[model samples]
Target chain A: MTMATVQTPPKISAQGVNVFYGDTHAVDNVSLDLYQDEVTALIGPSGCGKSTFLRCLNRMNDTIADCRVSGQILLDDEDIYASQIDVVQLRARVGMVFQKPNPFPKSIYDNVAYGPRIHGLADTREDLDEIVAVSLEKAGLWDEVKDRLDHLGTTLSGGQQQRLCIARAIAIDPEVILMDEPCSALDPIATAKVEALIEELKGGYAIILVTHSMQQAARISQKTAFFHLGQLIEFGDTTQIFTSPTSGRTRDYITGRLV
Target chain B: MTSLPNLKKRWGRPQVQRRLRRRYIYERIFRMLGLAAIGVAGLALATLIVSVGKNAFGGFVQTSIDVDIYLNPEDLRPSSARYRHDFAERVESADMRKLLADALERQFPDIDTDSERRRALQLFSLQARRTLRDYITATPEKIGQTVRMRLLASDDVDQVVKGNIDPRVPESDRRVKDKELAWLAALRADGRISRQLSTTFFTGGDSREPEIAGIFGAIIGSVLTLLVTLLTAFPIGTLAAIYLEEFSPQNRLTAFIEVNINNLAAVPSIVFGLLGLSLFLSILELPRSSPLVGGLTLALMTLPTIIIASRASLRAVPQGLRTAAQGLGASPMQVVFHHVVPSAMPGILTGTIIGLSRGLGETAPLLMIGMVAFVVSTPNALTDAATVLPVQIFLWADSPERAFVEKTSAAILVLLGFLLAVNALAVWLRQRFEVHIPD
Candidate 1:
């Protein structure tokens, strides 16, 4: 709350957003603000709607056949769900990394260059190469994969592929990056690498991370929101939320008693 | 009553051991049945190949008699000025059969009577005349020269040489008469009658005479028809599949369409023939008995197979790829075309090839469109009257001539070779282009 009081205008603001999959209210009314130059983590147990709420920011939930969203999610104060808004354009501005390190079955260069190529972010081959290099450099994968740029992206290890996904997301210069458990499939060493990469990438983009690990949110995120059973229990600075949660559910969850 | 010690006591009982033994027996029975099923399938396939090969061996080699005949200038008249501009016409009109009859008379000079000499001439095939005509036309300067040529023996002679017409079988029951067999023996003793590779069987068109009947024309017809089918069915089926699986909304209409497509695959191929008879031949007024109509009819029959296979393969592409593409701001169309379709391409090609191979072996459909006609000349165009390999096989199979039995088996082998090649190509394509999507 102290960090929220001193912040500039929120980069992305969700106001009473609700999501329904058929008859199930997957994401109940939840309001939160994500600020630029900071990592905000959404931490919850499984089926708590943290991932669903994260997908709503860029309308990724729209791809689901029976899923419906109500209320407003605004990026830079512009409603993303309005009919006039192009979902393609909205997604270009807000990229995503998935849980399973799903890289396109393409060469490392093409995998990083895909978003740029489709969005026409690069004017020439040289520009594209430079963009791929810089994106890989930023994702902390350039040193490992620069020589084998022509190798298929999936041939990389789990951690490297996850980093490649991050590079793919950032290649388009997306303003907001959403990660859904990007390290859950990785070993502890790979997870540590990704955590370090996130630390290095924190101030450059508004990162909204949905993670099962509360310690990951505490270690890397500047702000944290705890969700339980499709409702946000509390939101605050990372230290305050971890040490002294205002909600009883948040305290129980933090103490490993909520299950 | 159900304490831990009671459960242990029940486990030690003879009933439990009996149930375990019964389970083992059931497992053994299931495994034995599986092995028996495989053995039956293998035995059936082996029997089919062996029988077909045995029957077809006669069709691949032809019996011929080497004859040296003096080409008389009076008969050929190659020196005529009227035939100077059209030498082929002279060769065509020339009485090559008379020359063959004269050559046979020279080979069997002992046969002095007119009826015996005529019977000796009957041992040579009518193709022998064409063989002389082609050679004399190609080398017109050799007129009046004694040329040693190998000429085709009659189908009966060919059958006797190949052991299809058993000499020991009563002469009344067989096509080769005893007198003809004696002449064949004389020719064989003279080292004039010999068996060589049958070039005519591979190069010539169909004929009423099985000696000159070949599958070349049928192969051409099949190639052209399959070309048309592939060109029509592949894109249409693949695009339709992409639309249904990717773009089409999950509504009752699309569901109904899906049901129809699945049902169409099971519809008897003859039903497609009838449809082609009414639609393409009757309503569209396309040329009957032509490759064009045959191909269109087959396309109709093959569309459901291609569509069903393509849809299944398209479905096999991981949903994660689509989500990843869409998450990168790709439009719905872009998501499918860029990532999904490319990943599914190997599977689509395999399906398309399998469908085409099925169409290749299809007969009843082509039969309905009048492709069962007796076309002697090779077709020069899509609209020309042409019969496919299966229809040719069907025609030869129906003939009363004993020589045609081997020809039928040979044609079947050719068709099977084509199918095997196509399936091998499908397997190669799948291996070559399959994108490994890690789970």
Candidate 2:
């Protein structure tokens, strides 16, 4: 497996990022660059700081009282950690899906329309309906939920709820989508559906997926980074990371020997 | 034969048999103890209800004696022609006791002696003269006409008729004399008496005479006070809860506030009354014995309850909803009001209702603020002199009249009924508004 190099400038660049929870350093300094329309998968064992790094991309760590992040993360040459950058606007441009299907306790239509309404992406009810329909269709959920748009989002099955959350995220037209094990709570069939959805979503958004399943990272992501003990060990093409990793630690993790 | 051998072998283990027997016996004892505890509580509640109901039943039906009153125009007119402007003023200025005694003497011809006349007058309520005066003042043209009015009987007569006082008891021991008993029996036999609903109990104001006294003023005072408490406590408690749970930084100061709020709930309610007296009355100089003062005191007492309950409900709301709203770029305020608050509303309201009920039952704080005063008129405004139901019960229970014992019990039942309504509303709101999410 060989690395496929792209000369275009990176969409999001992180340099020497470190995260701390109180006195415990949860995530050590790491540097990486992600390009537009690419799926970058962060693979690690439990508590290996993959999810923490993903949260830092959108400033989600700010919600935790003791969590402290020290790093320089730039989106389109603008530092996101700058004092003038509002967290609300930062989250609007970088949407997130949690490990569990955390749909809002609202009607399906309302759930999908929430982001667009709050962001004022739609000016009228018709515009909102159109955005909701298009977003749901994009998430591959419109056909299953079209007849019952008013049904509560929580009443749906696990797979449909996850897709509904994806639809909700996409309704705001975010540039970056962060998934923290979005399919961990689903069955095999649901996982496959989410994987296909993520693959299709990479065409328009820079997607960063944190997954425990090595096979999922190889199948969906173009680039893969292996993390161990709060530190990034190796990063390269997904095929090279899976078939022939440069670092012995990454090789041991890929082979399920050092989990 | 093989199965029998295995069963015998298993049963032969001493440890297993002893453990099984001990567990069975322990289970039986635990079940019996639980049942006994429940039975004790149920019996206690039943005994209280029966005792209160028995005493209150008689209060619902009051005894009245019919009397024919004649208001002479000469007696009603000013004696020296001082020229009173209105009939109401003249009625107020006239000697009602003399007018009523003259009219009542016509009903009893044998009461020529002063002692007999006094005994006959003892059958009528002390407030009977005022009732006649009010009737005359209302209809001035009715003077000189014989108007038959059903007036409230005296406490002794009311008790005797209600079987609370035994007429067969010794004359010295019982308050009702033999002559009064005989007159009561004769009045009953002559169809000059009636037992009807105590409509006056729901309409009349507080009086020194228990037979004429009513809880109407206290009910109004309680309603007005509760309205003030709800308006003051609900919003403040909810906002405080939201700030503490959703917005406050987790530091020593916030932890101190949280712990103090919980401790405030456990503080004895009487201390709040003292606080109200000193803060609202002495320092603020609000009017004494008014619902405004009483309600403010009760609100202060209710605040801790509401805040604690609201915080619990706010904490009960799923953290996932807040994350979801925030993930969608909603500000912290939007996350709370649009998502967390809506999801926590049923719980918040249930807590608020419970707090309001506690305020309704509280008497000490209000008494500290001078709500124990005898309020003769229903309060027309927040600043008017007023009392609450529990204080009304305290006052009635302190009265020397036997009839007031029944009135006190009846007032307690009224208070319980109101509390039941409020709790029922809380349950209905929980059923209608609370969302049950599957895990």
Q: Which tens-of-lDDT digit does each residue in B1-439 have in candidate 2?
A: 4444577678788999799999999999999999999999999999999999999988777888987777777688875656687768878888777666776678766667877777788888887777888899888889888888878788788898898998678999988988788878878887988888888889978888888889899999999999989999899999999999998888999999988988998888889999999998899999999989888888888888888888888888877787788888999998998888888889899989999999999988887889999889999999999989999999999999899999999999999999999899999998888775543
Q: What are the per-residue Cα lDDT tens digits for candidate 2 across A139-219?
A: 999999999999999999999999999999999999999999999999999999999999999988999999999889999
Mark the 10 consecutive residues where model 1 chain A has the least summed lDDT: A1-10
Q: Runs in model 1 with CA error above 4 Å?
A: A1-5, B1-25, B73-93, B110-114, B140-145
lDDT of 1 by residue, B14-57 (tens): 99999999999999999999999999999999999999999988
Candidate 2 chain B superposition, TM-score: 0.90
Task: In candidate 1, list every pair of residues with a backbone clash.
Answer: none
Among the numbered candidates, top lDDT falls to: 1
**Clashing residue pairs, backbone N/CA/C < 3 A, model 2:** none
TM-score of chain B of each: 0.92, 0.90
Give the clash total for candidate 1: 0
